[model samples]
Target: MAKIEMKNPIAELDGDEMTRVLWAVIKEKLLEPFVDLKTEYYDLGLKSRDDSDDKITYAAAEAIKRLHVGVKCATITSNEARVKEYNLKQLTRSPNGIIREELDGTVFRAPIFVNNIQCCVTSWKKPIVLGRHAYGDVYKNCEIKVPGAGKAELVFTAEDGTEIRKTIQMMKGPGILQGIHNMDKSIESFARCCFNYALDQKISVWLGTKDTISKTYDGNFKTIFQKIFDEEFKAKFDAAGIEYFYTLIDDCVARIMKHEGGILWACKNYDGDVMSDMIASACGSLAMMTSVLVSPDGNFEYEASHGTVQKHYYRYLKGEKTSTNPVATIFAWTGALAKRGELDGTPELVDFAKKLEKATLDVIEEGTMTGDLARLANPPAKQVLDSWAFIDAIAAKLK
Candidate 1:
């Protein structure tokens, strides 16, 4: 079969650990054979990032912006241990964080539901797509550990030399204080991205926040999302037979647990960070979760929600076979390819992407999967394959 030619290049950000090893094999066995892969590749490995002073990550983000599509492998975000282990110049920031900030995007995470895999929440029959507003709030907060008694005040200074101050706490003893903020522009952008993504995916949108308590802070998010939905998306959502619902975060959680989910749950940054992981665990292993960062302008960067398989990589390095799941990584590629194909008007490429995804899922459904998924499989997989063997199984299915 002649390979399906790509009309545009994908900005491919490579990474570290076992996923990186699977990345090479996946390309050779799955993508390269069936598609004329055109990619502007950047090695985002820890060593490479250190060698280049992390400029490579910035360049990769720039390329994704220019090209409008990216598929990323899981990379190491440096910590004290990692810095010492890798012998790095300094502890670097998360590559994902850098790219997300550069793109100013919302992260959407959805699980890959297989027929044989049992969901922990037995009530959840459909996939729940979670859209996390990836900017501001507690993530960019000013925190202070107050020693002894001190007055904690919230102060705001305007450009015109006006000052507004309010005492938050009159501490009699040592306490902690934090000042968190979100930009209106960023919130508006996040709202639009969620609405646009829901519209594109033909799913209902659910916005949740602690608006009842944090009337000004969380209320702003609710208000912005509501305004955007009413002004921009109401007509389209109605036409598509979908609805946008809003409720308190606690209520939303209760409702989501009871109801069968096919809804896009748009969450505040902190809520999203916690809830996405919960949803991923309930649905299946983190390896089965797929994530995409979608900008307001529709640029996308796809990646697995799970981290690099560091333990698996170490075992493999010691010449031991390891069973690391690659489902999410494979889906990441399909997502990038499908979007690229759609943008470039190549239906064949889009179809190829779909088929590749089907192939991966079909392998899982057929009771051939890595150790993690096998453990979760219904009746359990009697025979579990190592990482490479599983990829080969998917390849055979594709053929």
Candidate 2:
């Protein structure tokens, strides 16, 4: 039989480590055989990124912007250790950060639930989607290490030379200073994305921030979201029988413990990074989460919420079989394909994506999974296959 055809190409950003190994195998086994895959491929591997002076990362983001659909494999975010390990030209930035900034997007992460793998949090009957503001804050920060005593000040100078200065700290000894910033415009965009997503999913939007402490900084986010919701989305939300509310971060955390999920918990940049992982772990493994970046202008980029399986990759390099979970990665592909098909008006392509996802979940429900999920499986996975074998099982189910 002929493979299902795609009307347009997907911007495929490839990555590193064990998941990178699984990336090619997944396409060869699960996707290529079943679909006429068309993608503008960009190698976001560390070595390639260094060789291109990180231009490839930007190019890939541009491709996603142009195509309006992207599927990314988890890539290594370079650090001092990574720079030496890969012999990189310099300390390169996170490819995910670059893409998120380019797209001006919000990341929505939700766990992929299977019947056999129970949630650690018993109260979570439904999936709790985390809407993360993907721009600014600690991800883009400035830091300085003081040698001795000095004064630290935050000064803003207007174009007309008007100056507003505030004292941060008066250091008496060696210390460090860090500055983080967020834009009003970016916050506005983040608010719209969350509200739009909530309306689409028919879920309540609960934004959490520490406005009482960092009155000005956190207050801005709260203010923007409230203004946008009240001025723009309040009516629509009321019509849909849904609601949007702002709460202190502490209260949100406490409420989440008792809530039955099914809420889009929108968070600021740093908060989202931490909470999303917490949410993912409580639901299941980090690899069980699906992440998607949605730009306000309708662009979508799907990726696994977890990082590259670096440990497994090292073992794999020594010619050992590693059972790394590839569920989130597979879902990333399905997500991109489904969106592509939906946008292209190709129902067949969308159907194929849905079938692939079902096949994956069915295999897990039948107690066939990799090492990571095997430990977490409630009834115990009947067959603990290596990564390749697990994909093969799903392929068989797909066929």
Clashes of each: 0, 0
Instruction: Residues 1-399, candidate 2: write the lDDT tens digits.
Output: 798999999999999999899999999999999899999999999999989999999999999999999999999999999989999989888899999999999999999899999999999999999999999998999999999999999989999999999999999999999999999999999999999999999999999999999999999999999999999999999999999978999999999999999999999988999999999888879999999999999999999989998999999999999999999999999999999999999999999999999999999999999887888898998999999999999999999
* lDDT tens digits by residue: candidate 1, 228-251: 889999999999999999999999
True-structure lDDT of candidate 1: 0.91
Lowest summed lDDT over 10 consecutive residues: which window, candidate 1? 134-143
Q: Report the Cα lDDT for residue 279, model 1.
A: 93
In the order shown, the candidates' Cα RMSDs to the true structure are 1.9, 0.8
TM-score of each: 0.94, 0.99
Cand. 2 Cα-lDDT: 0.95
The parts of candidate 2 lying over 4 Å away from their true place are: none
